[model samples]
Target: MVHQIRPRNSASASMASRKISSMLPSLMRQVIVAFIVGVLAACASRAPAPAPGAPAAQEPAPVRLGPLGGPLAVPGTLSQYRSHWVPVAWEELPGWQDDALHEAWEAWLRNCERPAPAFAPLCPEARRLSIASEEEQRAWMQERLRPYRIESADGNANGLLTSYFEPELQAARVRGDGYEVPLYAPPPGLPARQPWYTREQIETRPEVQAQLAARVIAWVRDPIEALVLHIQGTGRLRVQEADGSTRLVRVAFAGTNNQPYQSVGKWLLERGLVRDATWPGISAWAQANPDRVQEMLWANPRYVFFREEPLDALAADAGPRGAQGVPLTPGRSIAVDRSSIPYGTPVWLASDGPSAHLARLVMAQDTGSAIVGAVRADYFAGSGEAAGELAGRLKQNLRLWALWPRQ
Candidate 1:
């Protein structure tokens, strides 16, 4: 009975099951295809198509200010503004709007007196704008000036900044009342092309004294004070006359004796005579060791000659006249390497350190023998004792941007 049941519909059932198995694979394929189409539709809806036109070219990189490490970015379109100079916007100049630009205007007028060839054309406008306010001045500069980042020959913008100032000292017309040291004018015997008596010969030699005797402009009590005048190249003398009257006069740099300049403070520092080799420190060491004063002076062979110049109201108010033949304005004037920054060039300076934070517009109205580099400058602090203190302490990292007229 079991054999007869098994035989019934066995072949037909097997064929039907085989047919269903073949169809099942096709059904699964269709389901997977439908799911993939739905997923693609959802993705297309989520993300909008890009614009029809070609993609825009990438914008240029921002200008580099040089952070703590180095230049953080590239300066685009700046090199195109000037040859061998990089252009910058007013925003690049730190504290640009905050400063009292009137003070700088006064200095700019002084620059107009003997403007650089590039700037000479703008001098007339500069004079007209003298009475303008800070905002107006800034606008005037923006209209006429193009700021150029001062780069070294090797393309470095970083540099060193030092400072100098006028010094005031007590002086006497005659060698009496303990004022024995004499400041002399350029003597006829010392030819311009020849080296003259050094600090040693000028002080001790009778012949040197004879040569300089009639040329004496004024006398000072301390040898250190006399040295300071030589170091400063000019000084304000409070001269007490034989008539017991006192008057203020300026002694300007007539000439140098053609000898090499040396630093007594450096000499002392090399020998470890003082902890700090500033003028005050040198003076303190001198008080402690009076016997070595002559030795300290002889270390500097260079001698500076001066002429007695009467100070007018303008001259009295201004700093010493620089190589540019214009009286320098304190905090607005700088002594740059004439080769790097020509006389009458306007410079936007930036510097910050533990001692001072400096950012301003300054004129390259002055020069110094020591200020010899592509980016070196000696900042003119001011006149008198307070100015001296500031100048002596000023040595910092610097950056410069020359404000030239647009070509």
Candidate 2:
């Protein structure tokens, strides 16, 4: 669907003009002030007079979609599935709930500090049990399972922690040992597991230990005010090339704090300018006002302030690899639970001012930090500053369809 252009309110227009003015510095900051003046003078001098009989350009073609897929069954739907949500219960630790821990965790995640080496001792046991030679690990796992007499109807550990715990243990080992974490393909038919690492291993790894120590210190220092929150959102945009080619792009935005912009779709719905809150509806509106696109986004505080890099950077980061380091190519992306959304399903994302009806066939290869709940996804929109901007302004509902499932 396409949106028709309408005159904007004077207030909105004024806000747009102010926003454009403010953006000039950031957008053109690299250029010298004198250069900018000269460029503006040249533009003024070269401004062309409009021809009386000129005709408006034709609108571009609308995005299209293929077949829609059916809904995916939620993971762990089977009786055999076993999963647990382990909350960080550090609050229970006396003097450990202070703000130090929160700060440490953040520093560690940013790779600014290393975890301690105390976690090394636990690595051997973890490796022996889970990541030893394939034969040894398998034998150990079999022996452990023999005691529980736990058997799956499929004879597969479809929902068992044993399937993934070992790998996690190994990962912890590598990280704690100060070795580069090796990315590996999971064995076929195994359920995901939270890789286990010993506390000592966690404390010993420079990065991990730094985080642990920081968190502990923070809690010890300021328990009451140390809480932390994460926020995230995803949206699409219509990008116009200087040569006139147009493309629809999807972006993801993540940040700290409980900001309202974290809910991209909600922010758009509240705007009330678009008739429909869905992706197509908003894309239609954005396309009509190409010149004021950035203004509309900046007007909403929730839609701005992307953590990490900018929009362009983020898109570049989503190279052919999934977040989990899984390889992806055109027509092949990752998907998580179909209940969330099936893997390998094609979706039409409308964003910016153009519609990407068949923009990209995204696979649900990996999960996202905030990608919980049904109908949630983090489209890998590449990486860097451009990607960040695109990600930040992504506030729109989408018409999601599973092209793989005959819907």
Candidate 3:
């Protein structure tokens, strides 16, 4: 749902500049903490596992643990891209031998649908390996590809991992009976690159309303949920149609109003309305200040519209199509900074945190407005309430390695 088509020239540069400028205040606050975390994480890079029967130590080592609870470390040679690429041994990746790579193979197949130039030649072998044994697949990878640690241009490997999911909500074809918030399709004759009416304008002005009247794809019960759907860029709707029949459909991101996106949670925080800006916190504030719900929502001028598509059996089995123009594999897809990691690349990801400890292979299949920087990524956690909950709570430390075919 967070997939976006980003400009590659001046517009993107301007956006990046604005984003960095706006983040200065918060970045300044975390400088010290980030430094400490960076230092600890650097010491643990590309490490190897300890022997199986090794005796327990008095104090747990600072080594990063693999999925199977093995210590990892190995020195690597540094090269450069938009991010630094430090060549490392296959054994350097945590849990390299233990991952259920068959699960990730599906994502790789999807990547073959529109393979990057560098990856197009390898797609044939990748397809052949789909049904190969894990041992055979791992052997082929070691022989054909090289692993490189993905880090910032300055060589720092630690990064942030957040997540996003396709939300599932109930809707009504005709608005009413508590389903007053409308999820829209793009207004007719809307031009790209030009700013449209703001969120407040769309909500409060009759002229704007008239323009969007026929564009209502469906109406949902909660304004907050509608906003969430908008922010995530897509969602699944259990729609009660005018015919009084219920059917599940997906609302995919169609276009936006071209206004700058403002975080309503940030707005609340700035106004001293709430200390926590997460979804739960925002919901709490809305409940306590019901009279100001519209004001809170309008804090974000940007508006996303969606187009409804039927959720057939095939489509229902897969996640939404990413920016790569391929269906994303639930836990095996991640939105990466294309500037750092190109789309269709196979990546090894490791993260240890409260929400989840993950060590697996995932494809760089998507991108987002906030998923900037060399090391940053947004893990696609799939759809429904469980995925949404995981997505909402997952913000943690991350490390990455790109597996590229050797020339």
Cα-based RMSD of the predictions, in order?
A: 34.0, 25.2, 10.4
Tell me the lDDT of model 3 at 147: 85
Per residue, candidate 2 scores C-alpha lDDT tens digits across 202-310 of: 3235764343332210011110000000011222333333454644443222221122222223345577766544444544554565565434433423211111212
In order, the Cα lDDT scores of the candidates are 0.65, 0.26, 0.71
Q: Model 3: per-residue lDDT, tens digit, 234-339?
A: 7799999899999999988888878887655557779988765543455456556666766766767788878888889877968888888899899999998877
The runs of at least 3 residues in candidate 3 whose Cα sits more than 4 Å from the true structure, single-residue gaps closed, are 1-46, 50-81, 278-284
**What TM-score would each prediction reach against the true structure?**
0.77, 0.26, 0.82
- Point out where model 1 deviates above 4 Å: 1-84, 272-284
| Model 3: lowest-lDDT 10 consecutive positions | 8-17
The predicted structure with the larger TM-score, 2 or 3, is: 3
Which pairs in model 3 have colliding backbones? 46-73, 46-74, 47-72, 47-73, 47-74, 48-72, 48-73
Clashes of each: 0, 82, 7
- Residues 240-271, model 1: lDDT tens digits: 98898998898887776677766565678789
